[model samples]
Target: MKLNLFFQLSAWCICLCFSPVLAQQNYRNNEDINKALRNLVNNHKSHASLKSLTKTLGGKDVWVLTLSNGKPEAHPAIVIAGGVSGNHLLGIELSVKMAERILTNYKSVLNQTTFYIFPNLSPDATAQYFGKLKYERVANAKKTDDDRDGSINEDGFEDLNNDKLITLIRVEDPTGDYMPLEEDPRIMVKANPQKGEKGTHKIFSEGIDNDKDGVFNEDGIGGVAFNKNLTYNYPYFKSGAGEHAVSELENRALLDFLYERWNIHSILTFGPSNNLSVPLKYNSDRANKRIITSILKKDEKLNKHISEIYNKITKTKDAPKSVTAGGGFFEWSYFHFGRHAMSTPAWWFPKFEGDSLVKAPKNRKANFLKWAEQEGIENTFVEWTSIKHPDFPNKKVEVGGIVPFIMDNPPYSKVDSIAIKHSEFIIEIAKIQPDLKLINLKTEDLGSNLTRITVDLYNKGLLPTHTEMGAKSKWLRKINVSLKLGKGQEVLSGKKRLVLGIIEEDSSKQLSWLIKGRGKLQIEATTPHAGKQSITINL
Candidate 1:
C-alpha cells in the first residue's frame, strides 16, 4: 500500500544470460553466471523476458528467471524460484533441472501450465559453494555493513588454522555463554535459567574481529538473508535484515518481476523454511515432527488465525515495486498477487526426540555418528581435531556436522535421488491444484423448439474449488452455470448447485438445460469455481 517501493529497481536491471547451458560453464562466480542466465532469458523474448532488480540492502540486481509456454495471455503459469535464499541451492539446482524438464517433459506438461524458474537468486552466494571459499558465503556475494559500524565488510570469519574451512570453536573461556549438553555432551545448549543453570562457558566463531569493532567478526560481506528481511514482521534495522524492506537489490528485482506478471496463480519459494517438508515449523514451541492437532490444541484460535494470516501474507506483489525484499516477495505473492503460495528448505535434518543408540556401547560421545549411521548421513561430519590458535594455547574444533552437508550443502551425488523424489512430490502436488478442464459436451436433437444441452466440468488438480470445510464455511468462488443465448440475451442460474463440498479429479458433474432453439444456438457452460467452456448446439 505504501507504493510497494520494493520493486523500485525493476526497470534498470535486466540482468541476463546465454541461450545455452554450456555458456554457463565459462562463467565463474555468481555475478558471471547470473549474467549468462540473463543473456539466455533475453534470447527468448518471444516466449519470455528477463528482468533484474536491486534491493536497498543488496547493491546488485537479482536475476528474475521466467519462461512461457502455450498461447500467451490465456494460459495458467507456475513460477519456479530456486535461489531465493542463498543457502537453498537445492532449490536453484532443481530450477536448473527444470530447464532440462522443459526439453524433456515440457511437452507433456505445457498443455496445462507454464513454468518460470530462477535457479539461483543469489548467484554470488551460490558461487561461493563451488569456488575456493566454500564457507562464509551469504546471499548476494557482496559486502555488507552488518554491524552498521560505518565499516563495510571490514570483518569476516576466516580459516585461521589453514585447515581449509571455517569452523566454530567452543573454548573453555571463563566468559562463554554455551556449555556442553548434560544429556549429550557433544551438543551445546543455551543456559536455561528456570532449570538450575551452570555458570561457565562461551562460544566463538572461526575467526577474530578484523575491524576491531568491539564485537568479534560481527559484520561480514554479502547481501541480506532474504528470508529474515521481508516486509511482514520485517525486523526493521535488525541484524541480518538491512536498512529496510527490499534492502537488497536482488530482492527488489524479483518483486518487480512478480508485479509485471499477474497470471502467476500461486507463489513458490525455495528457501530456508517450508510447509511441505515440515508444516508449521515453529510456533511458540519448537517440537520435532510437529502434529497439527498439538499445534491447534496449544491455542486453537491463535494457531488458526496465524495459519490463515501467514498463508495470506506469503503469496506475491501487486504493485510490482512496492515489496520490501525478503518480506516483500512473500507478501506480494500472497497478499499482493492474491494467490496461493509456498516456501521450502531445500534440505533438512530431522532430529529425533531422544538419542536412541542402535547398540548399547560401553561409552558414547556426543556426536552425530550414531544418528548419522542410523540415518546414513555419517559422511557429513568431521571429527574434532586439535589446532594451534592465536587466542587459545591449544584449542580443538569439530569442523563438520549435519549442518555442513544436509542443512548447508547436500551431497552432489544425492541430488539426482532427491530431485526424483521431490519432482514426484511436485507433480503429485500439481495434480491437486485447482485445475479446470473441459471433459465432455453433448447436445440432443429433440422435437421442434426443444434441445438438451449437457456439459461436464473436471478439476484435475489436487485441491477442489474449496476445501470440504472451507466450502461448508462458505469460503469459495461462485458455483453456478450461465447460458449466453445471444449478444443481449443471457440466462444465469441463481441456485448454488456447486454444493459446498469437495470433488476429486476425474470426478465431475453434468449440468443439463432445456432450451428453446429452432436453429443453431450458442451455449456457454460456466463454473466459476473450476473455469468455463463454450460450444454450439442446434435443435
Candidate 2:
C-alpha cells in the first residue's frame, strides 16, 4: 500500500512540474524566465544547477544552467547559448526549452556529455518586449551614442500614431531611395535605376527627428548589442560593436568561464547568424591566408555534414537568407576559441506559395505581408496613416509598417514542436561526439624484470578528437597518453608521455612501451574533449 502511494505521489509531482508549461502563452519575461529556470533546476537537482554569470546594466542576471551526471569539467561539453540578439525572442525560448527537454527526457545522456546553457544574455533589451511601449531592440541597457553626436540616446523611436508601437514612418519624396512594391503597396522596396524605377518614399523608424539632424531614430535606447560585441574580427568603430570587443560584463563573464572549462568541444548558439540550415562555404583564398579568415577546408566539410544532419532531423525545408558574422560569438568560437561552433535561429517564415503567374515581389517585407494576409494573421502590418512630422515639415509623412519581432519569431503555440525537433538534433550531435577507446592490449614478458606493454589508442566515433581549428590553435589541449609504472619500474624505451594532435574518426595509433618493471603497468589516454580511458597489464 505504501509503495502504491509513493507511485501516486511521484505521478502527481511529475504533473505539477509540467503545469507551468500548459499555462505558458506569450514569450516569457525576465521574471518568468527566472521562475522557469528555478523550477527546472529544482526538479532536476540531481543533474542540473543554475548560477548567474553576471548582472547586466539593467540589473538583470545573465544566468548559466549546467547539466551533468558527474564533475562536468571532466566530460566533453557543449555550450548552448541564446539571446545573443535581444530582439530574437525565439532564441531564448529555444535555449530554455531545449534545456528543459534534455533534463526531462534525455537525462541519461548526461553520463558522457555536459551541457552549459545560457538562455538569456541580453535580458535588459529583451525585457523591452514586455514593457509599456514595444519595439525591436538589439542592445543592452547601457546608454550609447550610436550616432556619435556626443550625446547618449538623444534621438530614439516614438509612437507617432499613439498605438504604443514603434513601427515605420515613411515620407513621400521623389529623391528617396525607397519605393512601394508593385505587388503589395504596404511594403517598401529599393528602387532599381536599371529597371527604370524611381523611389517615391523615404523610410525611417517611427519617430520625429528629436536631434534635428535630418535623421530619425539614429541614436536609440540601449547600448552595444551582445551579438556584435565579440573578439573574432571585431568591427572596430562600427555601430553596435561596442567600444571594443569583449567590452560588456556579460561577454567578459562568459569568456572567463569558457576559457577555464577546457572540456568544451562544441558551441551551439541560437542567434541571427545561422550555419545549420545553410552551411558555411570554404573560401580557398581566405583559407590560405596567414590570418585564416575562412573556415578550414576540413572544417567546412564537417559543417556540411552537420547541416545535413540538422536538416534531416528537423525536416525543415525553408532556407533562410544568409547573414554574415562580424565580431559575433559563433565566429569567435571557431576562429579564436578553437571549437566547433554551430548557430541557428531554429525557425523562420516559410516561403509564400501563390500563383506562379502572380510574380513574387522581390521585396522581403512585401513577401511576408502577402503571406501573412493569406494566412489570416491579423495586425501584422499597420495601415499607413498620414502624420505631420517635425523634421520633414510640410512633407507627406506616415507611420505604418510590420510589427516588430513578428517576422522573426513564430507564435508561441508553435514553439513546442520547434523545440522538440531542435532538441533531437542537438542530441544527435552529442551522440556523434568523439569516443576514445583503448583496444588490443598485450604484454610480452622479457628477462631481467623487463616487460613490453602494447596497446592501440583509437577514436571510435564519427567526429574527430579535436576540431581542425582546435588542432590549429595552441590554446586547445591535445590528446595526452601517459604510462604509470609500478614500484621500481623505469622507462627503457618509448615515450612515457605522448601528446597527439587531432585524432580523426575511426583512426588508431599503436604504441609499445618497453619498461623495466616488477609486476604491473598502467596506461591512460585522455583528452579534454574525448574524455579519458585507462588499461592495466600484468607482466
Candidate 3:
C-alpha cells in the first residue's frame, strides 16, 4: 500500500511538471491560433468552415472562418475582424473566443444571419508577441524604408539593457520637452511652459542610433501598418501608410472579398479604436459634405443605442478613453464600405487603488502601474535603471517603462467571460438585422385583362436596409421589385421593375403597378442585404 501511494505521488509530480508546456487559456501564437481554428472548424463541420483569404508577403495566411446555418449568400452578414493593429493581442483572442462561443452555444443565431470572422489580419506582426524577444509591433512582415532614407529597416529597436524586451528610454537633459509627473515619478508628462513648468527630460523608445541618423528606432522592422493602409482617410505619404491605400496584399484581398459580399451589412472589428463604449458624435458639416466624411445623424443615434446595449451586457463603466484615429478599417467600413461598424478593445485595465486605498492616478500609465501593483502582476513594469548610452554620452539615460501590450490586454483567465458577453451582444445585433418582408398586398381587376396591383415592402427589422452612406455611395444593390406577367401581358403605368433605395426601420415603400395582364401574376421583391419576398395574385 505504501509503494502504491509513492507511485501515485510520482505520477502527479510528472503531470505537474509537463503541464506548463501544454496549451492553456492565454493569448495564442500563430501556430496555436491556426490549430485552434482548424479544430473549431472540424468540430462544427456542418455550420462552420475555415479558409485562407490571402497570404501575406511573409507567407502567413490571412485566415477567415465563416459560420451560418443556412446558405450564407441568402442572408445578411457581419464581418468580425481582429489584429487590425498587430500589437492588440486581446483583439485576436476576443475574436477567436467569440467565434468559438457562437459556434458552440449560440448556433441558433446562424439560422438567420451569417458571420465572417477574420481571426488575424496581421499574422506576421502578431507573431512578434511570441518571439524570443517580445515587443509591441504594428506593421506587417514586408520591409520598407519608413524614414525615406533609402535604407530599409536600418534603424530598428535595440535592447540597450539587453532585457530581451523593448521598453522606454528616458534621458535627463535640460532642454527636453518631458517632465516627471507629480503623482508618480515613474511616469512622465509633457512640460507645460504656460503653467510655468520647465522641460527637464526627453523620452524615447528603448533603442540606440544604429544608423547614426540622430533619430532612435525611426525606421523599424516591418512595414505597412494594416490599420493605416486602408483607403478611407488614407494618410498620404505618411510612414507605415504604404505608397497608396490598399497597396498591400492583405488589404487588397480583404477589399476584394468584401466587394463580392453584398450581404454583409454590419462589421464588428476588435482593435485599438472603439465606439462601443462611447458612440461617436455626429458632425453635420462632415456628413453633408460632397465626400460625406462623418457618421450621419440617425446612425449616431443607433450607435448610442448599441452602446447602451453593450454597456448593459458587459457591465463595463469608466472604459478607457480612445479616439478613432484616421485611416483605420473601422471608419472605412462605415464611410466607404457603408456598413454599420463597431470596434472595441474588448478589455482594458480597471481602475485600481492601492492597499492603502489611495486615489487612482490621472495619467494612464501611472494608473496602470497602481493597478498592476495592487493586483500583484509581476513583470509588467521595468524599474528605471541608469545606463550608459552611445548617443547621449553626457546625459543620464535610463531604460524602463510599462511593458508593451499589458495595458491593452487582461489576464487570459478573464478573457472567457469577456468573450461570452461580446458573443451575446453580437447575437443581439444579428437578431436586429434588416428583415425585409412583403406586406399589405392587394390586387384589383378593373376590366377584361386589366388589373391594378399594389404592395408595400416593409422592413420589419430594427436597422435600415442600407446605411445612409450606402444609399449615397450606391454600392449596395438596390431593392428590386418585379412583376412576372403572363403571356401577352403589359404594364401601362408603373414599369415592370421598380428600383428603390434605403428603407428605414419600421418603414415601408408603397409600390403600385397598373398592369394590363390576365391569369396569375407573381410579384417579387429582393435586395442582396435584406433578403427576398414574393407574392402571387390573379388578374
- For each candidate, the alpha-carbon lDDT, in order, equals 0.51, 0.88, 0.87
Per-residue lDDT of model 1, residues 1-539, tens digit only:
44555455443343322334344332234565555566555655545555555433334455555555545324455677776656556776666555545535544555455556666666666655665545645546446677877878777777665655555656665456666666556555667667877635556666775765546567766746665555555677766776777666666666666656534545566665444333332344432224211222222332243334333433211111112344534433443344444555544433333445444222223333444555575444444445565555554433322233234445555555555555544444444556565568777756655556677766666444443323332333444444546433222332213332345544666666666545555544333334445566554
Over 4 Å off, model 1? 1-68, 141-143, 182-187, 192-199, 211-213, 278-336, 349-406, 437-460, 465-532
Best by lDDT: 2
Better of 1 and 3 by lDDT: 3
Q: Better model by lDDT, 1 or 2?
A: 2
Superposed on all Cα atoms, the candidates' RMSDs to the truth, in angstroms, are 12.7, 5.2, 2.4
Tens digits of lDDT, candidate 2, 21-128: 776878989898899899999998999999999999889999999999988987899999989888889989998999999998998889999999999988988988
**Model 3 TM-score on a 0 to 1 scale:** 0.94
Give a tens-digit lDDT track for model 3, residues 1-539: 99999999999999898775565656888988899899999999999999898899989999889998868788889999999998898888888899999998899888888999999999988888888777888898889998888899999888888888899899999899999999898887899999999888999999988888788898988898899998888999888889899999999999998999999989999988789998888898888988878788878888898899889998887777765656799989998888888988888888775545587787888988888877888888888989999899998999998887788888787888888899999998998888889889888888876888788899998889987777878877889889898887898999888888889988998889888867778889888788888988877
Q: Assess candidate 2 and give its TM-score to the true structure.
A: 0.94
**Per-model TM values vs. the true structure:** 0.66, 0.94, 0.94
Worst 10 residues of 1 by lDDT: 314-323
In model 2, which runs have C-alpha deviations exceeding 4 angstroms? Answer: 1-23, 356-360
